[model samples]
Target: MFVEWMMGLAPGWVTAIPGLSRAAQLKALGNGVVSQQAAGAVRLLLERAHRT
Candidate 1:
């Protein structure tokens, strides 16, 4: 359930591999970042850059 929620929070479309091993799936999920958080960070950086 948690994984599904996290995936849903991603901004773009996410694809699931059908035959991935458990370890691979866990690794992918672990490496994934929240899209909304990343976008916010980028927006803040751009705003700061614009002020300079």
Candidate 2:
């Protein structure tokens, strides 16, 4: 895919990895739910609750 190739990954690397899909890769590369994002969301919610 053009996105993967542009990101410096070899053309076949996406398919080479088991369970990896183009949609998943694109989501991850774009606005996906990463660990840091989840953690930050939880932290923010907890802080907001504490402030109430």
Candidate 3:
């Protein structure tokens, strides 16, 4: 799913793990960071800071 990609995780990182329940998988994904999105947010903040 796109959420996995957002987390910068490889395919199957969430869904393919043996013994993981669906709810657990969802919780893990929910707790993950969207690395690229975070980077962009930080960059935007830095740019605005520099402009001030």
Candidates in order, TM-scores: namely 0.69, 0.41, 0.61
Candidate no. 2 TM-score: 0.41
**Which candidate should be chosen as best, given TM-score against the real structure?**
1
lDDT of 2 by residue, 10-41 (tens): 67555456787777867755653445667889
The lDDT of each candidate is 0.68, 0.67, 0.87
Candidate 2 residue-wise lDDT at 31: 53
Cα distance off (Å), candidate 3, residue 29 = 0.4
True lDDT of residue 51, candidate 3: 100
User: Which pairs of residues have clashing backbones in candidate 3?
Assistant: none
| 1 against 3, candidate with superior TM-score | 1
lDDT of 2: 0.67
Ten residues in sequence with the least summed lDDT for candidate 1 = 8-17
Error of 2 at 39 (Å): 0.4
